[model samples]
Target: MGKLGKRTVAAREAFAGKENLTVEEAVSLIKASANAKFDETLEIAMNLGVDPRHADQMVRGVVGLPNGTGKDVRVAVFARGPKADEATAAGADVVGAEDLMEIVQGGKIDFDRCIATPDMMPVVGRLGKVLGPRNLMPNPKVGTVTMDVAEAVKAAKGGEVQFKVEKAGVIHAGIGKISFDDKKLVENVRAFVNAVSKARPSGSKGAYLKKISLSSTMGPGVSINVDNAVAE
Candidate 1:
């Protein structure tokens, strides 16, 4: 059997016997254990109690992390005329109409967040098969499809994060980087939890938030108390 490295052993020792800790404690533990050469992203995963197969039970929404995600979000906008200019002026990395569609159709999608004007949906809809699977489809519910291109671009470039529950009823996203201070990380974590709590679908019954876990890019995950995570 291959022996565990010293860093792994130390990380496990630090996390020993620590289960279901408060949000703050879990963040601190995760940050401390992140000793990788690259800046580690602090990720949060929440197990929810809803089957997304049913339309009404789907859990998906956007939240502006109080302390930014500590990562640059690439934004692409589908618009024309003044709206396209507005997007470019607002710092959209890529902006176009059918041209953007062609780029995506050629399998050269390079942006993270995608936005679209209401009129551009006809063109954007054609790429649903490609973008939908990547969670980059523009939807009004998530503020990615609207006439206000500038604000949307700013929000995307800012700390706004969109989360959608997976097949296993789990929602996961990186809240921030380990380089972030403790206060910022805690604030971002709480903001995310509160957003998910508020997005609770009516179809969901008991225990909407079943479990919450925190971990760095290269470290082991540590479970956090659901109650503590939901507390304002």
Candidate 2:
């Protein structure tokens, strides 16, 4: 076997026997072990008990991280006339109407978040096949579809993160960056957890939050104690 790289070896040793720690402890460990050359995104993955296959059990929502996500979020807006101008004035990276749809149809989706005014749904609806799978489809429930373009764009560019449960009953999102203060990271993690908790569908029966894990982009995951993670 090839010798383990120094960073990899160090990460492994740092994670050994570390599991089911409190949220604060887990975040501290992940932050310390994230010694990558570049600033790494601090990611959180939650194993929930709901099945997305069932319509009523689907878990999806958005949360604004208090400390703001350290990454620059690219936003694409689909609107016409005044709404288009509103989107642009709000710092939207890409704003357009049918032309934007044509670009997306050509498989050239270049933005991370997609937003659309209520009137533009008819146009955006046509691209559901393209955006739905990417989880970039705008939804009013998540504040991505709205008439308030300015606030939506600002929120998207700030630290708002959208999360949807996968087929495996898991939801994952980057809460902050490794460089964030431990207190800020902990606050962001708690905020995200609370949002998911509040979005719990009526169909959920057992323990809603099954597992919580925190990790940096290049580090090993550290399991966080579910109770501590979900506590307000």
Candidate 3:
């Protein structure tokens, strides 16, 4: 088993559907059901029945199992000078500031994520038109901006992931499947919940966290209570 153990029969049974779900009830249920279960990744399926735009508010993001994303990630590192060399050495498909525009212009800047060194920020900024819609813009907040090429490459290669939220506050991300371990799934769920909570906009007043739900991509969302989840 990579990390999380197999998905328990309990989790499957507990998160049947949203026919009858209250925030607190869902949280207690998930917490209790996942005690001994282990799954590399949590497979959560959501039926928010909302627009993708609104659904964006619900889903936090998706993640790979600890056994690894299980497949290779197409990584492109934006760096120049020494950092470029470091990125290549660390296994990144290095792209330089000089060739940045042409690369973006060629319209083949297809990659799961993009990491740029501090020096390349200007260049990446110039190509905002090309990258904005793709959502591949470089950001340090997510650990994309850097001079440490090796660490960047390692993050890109090993733990590469993406994020987003749905309208119903039902963010769906992946953890290892039931075959991994329950702890892994629990840990992944915890990490995901923390991230989403922190992403709350300052303008979001009152009960920001109205509800929380987790499930597989094709599964159902088990709820998490947030009546007290809002920060004072």
Please report the candidate that would top TM-score against the real structure.
1
State residue 38's C-alpha deviation in candidate 2, in Å: 0.5
Model 2 C-alpha RMSD vs. true structure (Å) is 1.0
Which whole-number lDDT from 0 to 100 does residue 170 have in model 3? 47
Q: For this target, which candidate reaches the highest lDDT against the unseen true structure?
A: 1
Q: What is candidate 3's lDDT per residue for 1-232, written digit by digit as tens?
A: 5553345545566666643344334444554555542333344433333334542333333343344443356667778778888878888764667686677778877676788888778878887888877767877766778778688678667755666544443445454454444445455555545556666654444555554555443334565544322222
Question: Which candidate would rank higher by TM-score, 1 or 3?
Answer: 1
Model 3 regions lying over 4 Å from their true place? 1-71, 160-172, 226-232
Give the total clashing residue pairs for model 1. 0
Off by over 4 Å in 2: none
Model 3 lDDT, full chain set: 0.57
Ten contiguous residues with the weakest lDDT in model 1: 223-232
Residue pairs with clashing backbones, model 2: none
Q: For residues 1-232, write the lDDT of model 1, one tens digit per residue.
A: 7999999999999999999999899988888889999999999999999999999899999999998999989999999999999999999999999999999999999999999999999999999999999999999999999999999999989999999999999999999999999989999999999999999998998889999999999999999998898788
Reference-based lDDT, residue 32, model 1: 81
Alpha-carbon error at 132 in model 1, in Å? Answer: 0.8
Candidate numbers sorted by TM-score from highest down: 1, 2, 3
Output the lDDT of residue 182, model 2.
96
